[model samples]
Target: GAGVSQSPRYKVAKRGQDVALRCDPISGHVSLFWYQQALGQGPEFLTYFQNEAQLDKSGLPSDRFFAERPEGSVSTLKIQRTQQEDSAVYLCASSKTTGPGYTFGSGTRLTVV
Candidate 1:
């Protein structure tokens, strides 16, 4: 992919249901990141991966949230027991390195009801 790609641009989940969001990063990109954005807030880092290795996951709100990049190219973010607070736009971004030059996906909007 020329840039990051996320599937199911919009989602509506019943409270307590589980949901999975996918992200496909650009070819050969070494860094992948997941972020969460509320209606009026900036994106907050959820996790980060460098290749097949997960380098950071401190931002995940709870054990219900998980992310993986097994092959280092495609990634998934899963949220278990969705709650109303989970309603937000989940964003994925990729870059060749750590600091800049990132290409961000349009984001997956999840609305828990």
Candidate 2:
């Protein structure tokens, strides 16, 4: 089975630009989650989707952040009008169920200038 993976392990963006990062979850997984982790801080939940249905998105910081899991597997997180504060490691994880553990991608490190 394929493990979760994320692209552009590092990114540098100028403030006010838009960026899109991609994530590929494991096959047949029913739950997917996105999180943001600031330097030296724990990962914070950003959103979650069960298949193509978005189950939760309470943790998205602002309107600038948006995510989607269209095909019930692959997902993308897009940031509009990037700001310095948006700099962080964006992580994606998936699980067979809402169980205890999840498989996480390496994450995309975004740096807003």
Instruction: Return the TM-score for each candidate structure.
Output: 0.97, 0.96
Each candidate's lDDT (Cα)? 0.95, 0.94
Reference-based lDDT, residue 40, model 2: 100
lDDT, residue 6, model 2: 95
* Residue pairs with backbone atoms closer than 3 Å in model 2 (clashes): none
Which regions in candidate 2 have their CA more than 4 angstroms from the true location? none
lDDT for 8 in candidate 2 is: 83
**Candidate 1 at 43: error in angstroms?**
0.5
Pairs that collide in candidate 1 are none
Off by over 4 Å in 1: none
Give the clash total for candidate 1.
0
